[model samples]
Target: MISHMRRLLSLSTAMVMASTAIAAAEPSAELIAAAKAEGTLTTIALPHDWCGYGGVIEGFKAKYGLTINELNPDAGSGDEIEAIKANKDNKGDQAPDVIDVGLSFGPSAKADGLIQPYKVSTWDSIPDTAKDAEGYWYGDYYGVMAFEVNKDLVKESPKDWADLLKPEFANMVALAGDPRTANQAISGVFAAGLSGAGGDVAKSGEAGLAFFKELNAKGNFVPVIGKSAPLAQGTTPIILRWDYNALSDRDTLAGNPPVDVVIPETGVVAGVYVQAISAYAPHPNAAKLWMEYLYSDEGQLGWLKGYCHPIRFNDLAKNGKIPQDLLDKLPPAAAYEKAVFPTLEQQEAYKEVITKGWDTVVGANVQ
Candidate 1:
């Protein structure tokens, strides 16, 4: 009789564990109905190819059948926060329901009351280091900086940050965004500085400014915000962006332009982009539902398809959720070995030095 009881107890424990897992993955029926009633979610600064957001967005729409009103596909991380701040009083089309921005912007956005807190179902799976205690924002994905070049446009593709300044690259090199407001562009400057400073992160901002100043003076730099289309067309032959974007661009170009995504030999800086809902979100339920979809296993894998390392990577890997083929497609593990992640303080400090000095020190207004 005791043996029978033990077996029943074991079966009950297994059932409870299975049910708990199911509960975490699926949203509450009430939340889903509420989101459906809202019928829309507004987002800002989400380029389709960046970080595999294109697929993720499609999956959400197909699942929930809600219209996602996309706003400003090319806007920067700072611009996303500004959108929330500017539309605080207005809850209609202009107000964004959600934002995906750089790591440094998370705390600032929360402190400024531009974002509200809502922990997703998979919140615990996210690393504590990458998320806020109050859940205002959490890391979505990360990638190291790299140069994406149109191989057909140039005889020889440069391999490092210094090579971009060579005369051969004259009128060819472009930053991914305006350093004044774009996190990617600002991080591009910081990465170049890291290369210039021989990896002293504290000195990266000043060193980056000097590097761009020279790139501009030598007529090598293209003063424009860059995108995959521009890179393929040779308008901007060389663009500094996250490795994931570069890889995705290469795939999208698909040998017509024959792109090369190269990780610099030095100054390998990795940046993390975070996700949050707006404090003044018009479709608050849909926004929360969107967050749920992003942090879910399916959403995480979508980002992986775009070549980004999702913030929930560790948890996914530990559970054997990641596919072998997906892992095989990424750049070699060795290339990422030297990647350095900057602290929030370091990024914040350098951001001030870079943004405040870009106009005066670099003297090139990137449109």
Candidate 2:
């Protein structure tokens, strides 16, 4: 009787260990089967080079054998919003499963009720500041606003907000575009405002206006649009651009026109490239799967390889996935230690301040 009891106990222990191993080994068979049934995913994206989305498409296709159809819009965010509004009814054929756009447009997209809320399981891994509370959208990558200077143009590069105001940089500095038109340009203006460029503009409309007026007087202003490469190639010596865009230019112009990027001593405003799912998406399940994959450890590391800061900084740091050579290319993490978001109050204030300021300062001065 004792021998028989020992055999029964040992067999039960082996059965429990086998069950635990199976649970740890793979995803549920149900999920894999559902993904196979989804068939395809369609995406609409801003005008990023193939390098930006290529890896993601390849990864998704290899894992699920699903087809990915991508559409690149020629017009900006306004055009994308207009397209969605026009096609709200017959969505599957007309609308994309997912869309990517600039940061400022994220709130507007949410307000229009064009986006759906679906937080990935990895949501907690992303910082709260980088994502919407209700999961309407989340930022995948971001660039810090900085000065891209030509080494040959000025004896020394402008190091801070105050340096641009000097007489020496007169007619030598250029901005991306009118703040009313370009999201990046607006970020630059606000960053300057936050750093005391226009006195009290951090809290008042008059401050932003006064700063632009001073810039106009110093002859330190030029309005350039859509072409940062030519500007860095020496058409204009000093231009405002995001760090990655500037780095791309610097890499392209290795010997000629030699450009260098610097985060202004005052502060850096981080502008993001955000992604969201369409409210009327045909493949909602697949879209959710894509977002989940994007935030996973594998997908987040891809962003670091592509030179865009991954949204989950802590995860990347913990994994040691960010290489030393790449770390050398980026601004010190301290530069982003105190980053601030533009509050709803600031966005409202900007509509009036930036528009009116342009009329008074840039419009009056343009020949």
Candidate 3:
């Protein structure tokens, strides 16, 4: 009788879990109609070239007949937060309806009452570790840190963080953006710290900052934000950026300058970015619909085309939803088999360290 009761209880719990997932995922018909009526979504800090946002924006506009007003294509995570506070009361296109930011910023945004709760239709497909419990934010996609080199200017490709320090790479190294404000650059510092201090980002970010200080002093590091134009022009031949961005640049500039995308051997880091609805969204329903479309199978696959691994990658692969052509563009499965993801707490801790130390430690002026 006791065993039978235990089995019954287990089955009941499983059923409840499934029901909760379904409840969170299903949007009301009224909600869909209301979104279509609103027909616009304002966003900030989304660069079209980064993480396939160019295709995503075009696809979303075409699919729902909604106009997406994207502001500040080159802004950082910090800038997005500022925009939210600055335009909270403005009922205009300038006020953002949605935001996509580094995972570390999610908690702070929620705490500040800047973002609201809205679960996507594909909520269950996302990993529990990558989403807020109350649905305030959820990861969209991720990429690993990598060394992006312009082969035309760089005779030898850098295979690891250490290799970038060699004389051959002098005056060649640049970061995706400013570490103080940009998620990618902050993660780059963490990746370098892993190699500099033997995989200890929890307490050795200062060492990573020190490494950059040396890199700057040696004249190997350029004080410039990395972009495809700099790489193509040979101004910034080697960029330390996300793998997705590196791969995108390589494919985008196939023959002009020739690009080499290499995942660093020593300290590789995978960082996830999440999307959320603004608490003061002028087009709230449209914002919700936008999130739904992004998490849908179609949206995930669209991100895959740009080489970013969607948060639902494992789930999608298990369901056999990934297309072969897109899969062909990805690095070997082995390359990411042991990829490291620092916890949100860990990322927060490292952000504090980097933000506080960047000035006294490295301080490479990029004016």
Q: What overall lDDT goes with each candidate model?
A: 0.88, 0.63, 0.83
- Writing each residue's lDDT as its tens digit, candidate 3 over 1-367 gives 2222122122232322323243235456887789889877898988888889899888888887888888898888878888899999997978988888999999999999999999887777677778899999999998899988898888889888888789888898999898888888988988998888888767657877988998988889998999999999988999999999999998889878888888888787889999999999999999998898888777888899989988766556655678888888888766665467888898999898997899888988652
Which is the winner by lDDT between candidate 1 and candidate 3? 1
User: Which of candidates 2 and 3 is the stronger one according to TM-score?
Assistant: 3
| Runs off by more than 4 Å, candidate 3 | 1-27
List the candidate numbers ranked by TM-score, top first: 1, 3, 2
Backbone clash total for model 1 is 0
Q: Which ten residues in a row have the lowest lDDT in candidate 1?
A: 1-10
Q: Report per-prediction Cα RMSD to one decimal.
A: 7.6, 11.5, 6.1
lDDT of 1 by residue, 246-304 (tens): 99988888898998889999999989899999989999999999999998889999999
- Return the top candidate by TM-score: 1
Candidate 1 regions with alpha-carbon error over 4 angstroms:
1-24
In TM-score terms, candidate 2 sits at 0.74
